[model samples]
Target: MKAAAFDYAVPKSIAEATALLGSNGAATAAIAGGQSLLPMLNLRVALPDLVVDLGRLEELKEIAATRTNIRVGALTTHAAIEDGKLPEAFGGLMQKVASKISYRAVRNHGTIGGSVALADPAADWPGCLLALGAQ
Candidate 1:
């Protein structure tokens, strides 16, 4: 797991992260939880010169219900979504999906954003999310 020297920042707001991305153009990237990206970095598949960690962005940790849908923050982890503390609107789908995720340990840390961002044709969540019309 080798990585090159790079600049790292824990941006408290989306504006700061946006500024970092804009300044560096494609050389910068956003990382939440760093589970997948860390492995990619170790394998040398990505080489972002700057990583804007959004771990401290409390505004992005929301899981709220709208009139017709559940609005999950892009950074919300699977565990949070499956916490079973959500309003009745979600219909236990989150919990079902959460339990069937890769593994309990991984489900705890894996974010929904990571699943969709993977863009993998064979990912487990993709089927369920698509079946639920969550694209």
Candidate 2:
């Protein structure tokens, strides 16, 4: 099935996205890579009145690492992790997990934030992140 009709917005900044979401209330949905949300939208499981695309927000795509901590941006793709784009501090754990999520196509567009936000019991990232003491 195809998704129901909905308006789409591509916000330039986090604040703009937040305002869009708040203005629309419960009828709004935010999409990053759309790995999880797209399927639900197509199946009519998520019929949001508006979809705020966060893909182009550069702030959400950053990655920073310190001596003892690492901050991964929400828009980071699984393919990036699988391809060793992250700092070596993780000891290849994230790489191994990213390689195993569905398939290459999905990994190319799927994001760590999307996976975690879905909170699917069978999903890999959330449990892995939780176990690693992710904040």
Candidate 3:
């Protein structure tokens, strides 16, 4: 099934993205890598009036790590982790989990934030993050 008609926006910055998301009231959906969302949209499972694409938000793609903590941006893809793009301090747990999420095409487009935010019990990222006590 095709998605219901919806408007789409690509904001230049995080603030702009938030503003666009707020403009559509409760009918707004934020799309990053679109791995999970695209399927839902195509299946009409998510009928948002507007889709605010977060792909251009570079801040959401950052990764920073310190002695005490690691901050992974929401837009970080599974493929990145699988390819050892993240800090080595993580001990390869993330890489192992990322490599096991579906296939390479999905991993290339599926994001950690999308997986965790979707809150699917069977999703790997959320369980792994939870086990690691991620904030």
In model 2, state the lDDT of residue 104: 99
Question: Model 3: what TM-score?
Answer: 0.95
How do the predictions measure up, each by TM-score?
Answer: 0.84, 0.95, 0.95
Candidate 2 off by > 4 Å = none
lDDT tens per residue, model 3, 23-68: 9887999898898889999999899999999987889999999999
The full ranking of all candidates by lDDT, starting with the best, is 2, 3, 1
Best by lDDT: 2
Model 2, span 1-135: residue lDDT tens: 999999999998999999999988879998988988999999999999999999999888788999898899999999999998889576789999999999999999999988888889999999889988999
Cα deviation of 54 in candidate 1 (Å)? Answer: 0.9
lDDT string for model 1 (39-107, tens) is: 887787878899888778887778788788876777788777677745545567768877777776776
Better of 1 and 2 by TM-score: 2
Lowest-sum lDDT 10-residue window in model 3: 84-93
Clashing pairs in 2: none
Q: List pairs with backbone clashes in candidate 3.
A: none
Off by over 4 Å in 1: 88-90
Q: Assess candidate 1 and give its lDDT.
A: 0.75
